[model samples]
Target chain A: MSEILYRILIQGGSYKVIFNGLLATLRISCFSLIIGTILGALICMLRMSRVKVFKFISSVYILILRGSPVLMLLMLMYYGIFARSSLEAETIAVITFSLNVAAHIAELLRASIDATDYGQVEAARTLGFSAWQAFRLVTLPQVIRIAKPVYQSTTINLIQWTSVVGYVSITDLTRVINNIASRTMQPMITIIIGMLIYLGLAYIIHGIFALSDYLQTRREEAA
Target chain B: MKKFLLVLAILLVTSSAFADDYVGFLSRLKTTPDEFFMMMKNSWSTGGWVILGGDHSSSKARFYDTLTQMQLALNSGEIDEMILPDFVADYLLKINYNYSRCCISSSGKMGLCFGFMKENAALRDKWNEALSSMLNDYSLIGLAYKYVKNIPEDESYDEIYGINRKQLNKEKRIKFEHFKDAPTVKVAVTGDLPPVDFIGEDGLPAGYSVAVLAEIGRRLHVNISIINVNAGARTAALVSGRADIVFWYEINKSLSVQPDVPDEVILSMPYLNWDKFFHVTLSDTE
Candidate 1:
């Protein structure tokens, strides 16, 4: 126990770096999540549009962003796209990760929409419901429910992927852990703690989804 | 139980793919594209990473993304011998018993210097002046002896090499002074190279570069902030204006060690020349 403590907390007072790194990770993840969601909704709308041009553009965007490696995308964004621009590495990382997440989330939303029962929307229209009302009443709920679990998975994945931010000069959680490991020469212990912390973050997101599911069930039961 | 296991598998696979690189798919995510291509070309070898001799000659040498991977490959018997910087090899020999180290060759070494923007000639000259003073007075070599040449032979009381060995103190970090109204220079330190440009466990930059920068800051009365960057993005930091100066390792054209100033970014005078590279292999008996 003391050995673990020394490795994580005492040895070189590494916990400070750990905490700062965690905060950087959280900040980047949060920024990526928010911006990615908004951008994803736009792509989803574009993919579902009646205009062929919009559909083609959305298809290409998804194809490129989804197909390319995130690490490569990040480096290109930093060293190529925004190379001359006076943007910080972390901001460039957020932009890159957000684009990648937006692609995946767009696909996720489209799949959830496809999974929703069109029959219910048709039935709602027959029962004198407007298009918006039918979507709000029948289609949206099912889409949200269907997207929940996968959304949780995607969020967890994004959080984990943020570890690569260190590659771009950001001293994130993973880098801090690496710093500690390098400083202390206790790779096993330091990595175990890092994994546990990441696991804890993943579980927290998992728990949030689980709670939403339970609340959703209660609401359905009450209705 | 099934869900727990599924998540665990995902953790191992994904984290290894993109994060927690110490134990990952050995060659997949870490290395530069060039190094990765090298690994692919030599796909038969279970382990491959590059280690340039101190003499700046690398042929048939493998490349690694991080030092930790080198250690992993060496221990797993994937590689015959691991080549490393002389200071680091000596430090590792003291702590690790099974390891035996030898200098590979010592000739035609490159100069390590501070890189700055093309327009920032004034800032470049300030650093050059400070470096020249250090070189003339031999204070730079003295700092290297304090940090690099003086690794403790005892394997006991081992933690990280962040603590200065001679003083046996972690608290007294050589830090840059930030004056009340002085111009602040954001210098990037990778902390990848230990005992030289390394960060201590105290979360402070303390090593040869830090000591030299500290003295320069004191002499010039300029505020200097040492920012830690990954070794890969030193140039990115400089070009993006995120850092005013960065440590650059250059193989120059001159006979003796001289600053190889590139056209786009000027380089300060060379502070250290790594004339010796050490190759360490596991002792058979151990």
Candidate 2:
């Protein structure tokens, strides 16, 4: 009986419930990373800007988002800010996560940019390289190398945090596992399976980052 | 990077200013009954008591957010037994025979009903009217049985709930009134309690309360939207206006207990009541 129950949960069509949930998690994480990258760059510029107002707003944004729990921010965004709106929970999750990632990535970019050796850029300029060329050739590569691991960590944390989206009624991976386990009254094996899947997901993300680093190194050597 | 660290430090310090009592974190952890009683309790519980800090005023029993979590904790030996409503225990034990239920010594009784914000008093009344009509015809009781008594014990659980067996129970999943011209009201359900409140495998709200909501929607002539949420977040969902109505338990006079109901919530006339509590443990414990 236990075997049949486990089989029906995994091999049977009920597994599709878990698969669809994984897809939702992947969609939100990927969307947040893409939008966050763009927004992060903009926010990074504002943080480093000479304009006092923009700098103040950017600092507060970073302080508010980075200092508080992401789950709390997601709830505040969903229930407090957009409470009256007819927006889907998924939409709110994406928007909230994107904003959170933006704050972290912005600070990451600012710190990395600040840490770069300006002497190399000056040397590139002296060699008749334009400002953009100097940044592209001498500074950007260094910044990426310095920021690669932290950025990957931030993105991975964002993915894991998406588990909390179920609080708002969005059926992400964690919620699916809980629903299945609770409904069937078979949580031991179910929880083990869920844990294995999450670990696998984290490994996949880690591998992607490793591959990106390898490719970046290869490009630099080839150049 | 040093300046960045400094800024973060300032933020941390400033956040403490917002807390009225900032004696630091260590002072906040409340310990009770001195060290020896705690030692005995810890020895009794195999370290679970230390985690729970037995007999603490501020904390209650090890609170689990969902039924699954509670079961996991039990299996892990973190908890000995789980206290649950009689029907919920019945539903759980029906699926998994590995678990056993024991009688709990409690006379507390509570009734399940829909809760709305004070501002939505009229909406609450409308639902009450529809509920009365359903009760008058015995359809409400019948609806509760759809997932519980209606499910034949011989059949597979999947087939009963249409998990992997979609072709089965095509008519079993209740469809609510989706009137195009009528105003829509969003109702929140945790789907944590199966056969009573749960989502079907096809990712639609199933079970008794959903069926009741469907019948009420028909009588009220309003479109009903069901939102799935974690059980712990039900009240938050309602109070935030994400759900116009959510499940709220009303403690009966016989129970003589004031439930931890929110001040803003206005409960509807209860549609279902249960007086029994059960202590559930692994079957091996029997």
* DockQ (CA atoms), all models: 0.25, 0.43
CA error at residue A211 for candidate 2, angstroms: 2.5
In candidate 2, stretches whose alpha carbon ends up further than 4 angstroms from where it belongs are A1-12, B1-60, B106-108, B151-168, B248-250, B255-257
The residue-by-residue lDDT of candidate 1 on B211-248, one tens digit each, is 88888888788888777777666667787676789874
User: What TM-score would candidate 2 get against the native?
Assistant: 0.82
**TM-scores of the models, in the order given:** 0.78, 0.82
lDDT agreement of model 1 with the native: 0.72
TM-score between predicted and true chain B, model 2: 0.72
iRMSD, all candidates? 2.7, 1.7
Please give the CA lDDT of all the candidate structures. Answer: 0.72, 0.75
The TM-score of candidate 1 is 0.78
Q: Best candidate, lDDT-wise?
A: 2
Give a tens-digit lDDT track for model 2, residues A53-106: 999999999999889998898888887898889888899999999999999999
